[model samples]
Target: MPPETPPRIFAPDRRAAVRRRMLNLQQAPDAPRYLLDDMIEDVVERLAFLRHRPQRALLVGDIHGSLQAALEATGAQVTTVEPALGFQEEAPYPFSGFDLVASLGTLDTVNDLPGALIHCRQALEPGGLFIASFPAAGSLPVLRSVMLAADADRPAARIHPLVDVRAGAQLLQRTGFTDPVADARHLAVAFRSFGREIADLRAQGLTNVLADAGPPLGKAALERAIDAFSAASKDGRTVERFEILTLSGWRR
Candidate 1:
């Protein structure tokens, strides 16, 4: 079968923004990154259920380098793939004999989700495990609603494209993975204001990357969005739910 062509719906400017933010994150080192750290913790927690530790592992889009340390703590020789390393379409896919592979917060933004998943499975030896997580399907419902309200009768595309967990599982199975499993973990966060929520998104590389994203909200629209967001607040704090989905499978 021919490879599925990924849509060119994300822009280069978005990639540049992510690079700048990631660089800032590396410097802060000890700064608070709740969402990112949670994903890393979740991945580590899942590893506890495995009978044997992985001998060789791969970490894609290493977040704050915490995951690398965690993987190394288990004595697994781990290799990291950073986005700034620029492993674009033209580059050779590296799936070489890894016993375990994990990715965090990167698959959703990829140009070719299916191709990437396929390569991840191929890189692993038989019985090798793959665990990956991304902000999929039900992420940021409040923010999405606010953005749409900001545009009122003429909503513009302001959110990044998110993968549905069902489709992700299908891709894993289609790519010849065995025992594919996918599940969503919900994170409920309370923020004092919408601006704070936006800041969290920036820190997590969860901004609008859509090539079709329209212009920034004007002053009036911004006010409307703020009001709409505030209306959903409870006890002077807005509640937001972030649905992060974890995908797991084993190389057949």
Candidate 2:
């Protein structure tokens, strides 16, 4: 029988190893959740421009866990790239000029939304279409209220640094895309319990706001949060509202 070999230990430092482990603990699954599917479906319904077979299409979206929608939006022949979260890569521009490029609710979370749009425009053919959806800065007041009540001494959560519709249109125009326009899609639903709402957010990759002020939540804080949310609920359920802004332009 051959001699057994010991496992290799490659970590250079204990602190570095601990940091990596913590990152792994924070890492979440890259799959869509139940209600998030409905949210994406609703967005797809509004994307009427995706009816035909463009010579080439580029799909850009910040679907941390909503990869299903991203996969469905891009065609089988289409070359896709996500550039963030798990699948990070710059797309090889597939055509001399792409016929269309789209980012559905992804740009808002990016460090440079305008830069991404400019990159998309440069990749497209003249007269090519650019379509995107992003949550407006004005979304989810009800949830914000609950967060405020629970964490009174703490700063409010900025879940996503979303762009307003006007600014989003300006970004598209600034990228040298023409006839930029913006529209809104408001999603409203009621959850029976606050826990369900939080679960949905987790599944959607919407809960990882990095600015929590307190230490890891203790039992009392959690109970207070639940109570705050329950009291905020209207009638029998808490109303969850998401205001999404859809924008489009043409490469001129």
Candidate 3:
């Protein structure tokens, strides 16, 4: 008898396609997630950087940007919940016994950001640090402007609705993370075309959070948006700027 042949394989899923398209809007990957992850790792190597050796740590939320930073702050021996690798689906225990708890950029995305912070507080030992970073209110002004100018009839996107330096600090304090501190860094991302900027934004998992993202762009709107973006360009490149805020506090 002849062996049976397998059926044809399909391409990617529609949901995946949507995700990919949506992710393309941001000019960069979640900055707090990526950058802080590196910071964690690098901070670990130097003894002076440690301030104190962290035997155990908890990295709250899922932001690849800050993974390395968390790692650096917390040594390899340190146990981390929602561990970096294969950690997406895993939400380990509260880790209330940990010496340190670093949130990176998780809180902002939560529906109840304050509640999440409270949970972080509960998950740490007394006086343990709880650090985080989130896209500031000042982020993505240029992109927002272009979109708004292009589609005057439609409502603007709710792209960046998180804390800036002031709001982050206040939230930390309000959430009972004592001695809260916050700072921001303005990073400008330049793109050759508006399409590229939108694509990069999506790749970075940062894009319009508008309740109604609105219907598919009409030809006129697309052309208008492109024109507006082109006008915003400098030195032959369109620019999208973001002000990322890093915030931290300690459990009292």
lDDT of 1 by residue, 45-161 (tens): 888877648889888777568888877887889888767556552234655899888888877877777777878877888889998888888888999899999999998988876
Find the 10 residues in a row with the least total lDDT in model 3. 6-15
Candidate 3 TM-score, C-alpha based: 0.72
Error of 3 at 212 (Å): 4.4
Q: What's the ranking of the predictions by TM-score, best on top?
A: 1, 3, 2
Model 3 agreement with the true structure over 1-252: per-residue lDDT tens digits: 973442222112322343344333333544223334333443343324447556667664433334535455445344444322233211334446666666544344444456566777777778677666556777777777777777777855445465767777787888787777788777677788988877665554455433434566678888888998889888998767767677767776
TM-score for predicted model 2 compared with the true structure: 0.71
Better of 1 and 3 by TM-score: 1
Clashing pairs in 2: 105-133
Give each model's whole-structure lDDT.
0.80, 0.59, 0.58
lDDT of 2 by residue, 1-252 (tens): 973442222111322333233334335564334333544564455444445345576665433335333435565234455533333212334444776676654455444455557777778788777667656777777767766666668745435456777787787778787888887767786888878877666555455333332355557666777888888788889887888777777787
Q: Which portions of model 3 show Cα errors greater than 4 Å?
A: 1-50, 61-74, 78-93, 210-212
Model 1 steric clash pairs: 95-123
The clash count for each model shown is 1, 1, 35
**Higher-lDDT candidate of 1 and 3:** 1
lDDT of 3 at 29: 45
lDDT: worst 10-residue window of model 1: 86-95
lDDT of 1: 0.80
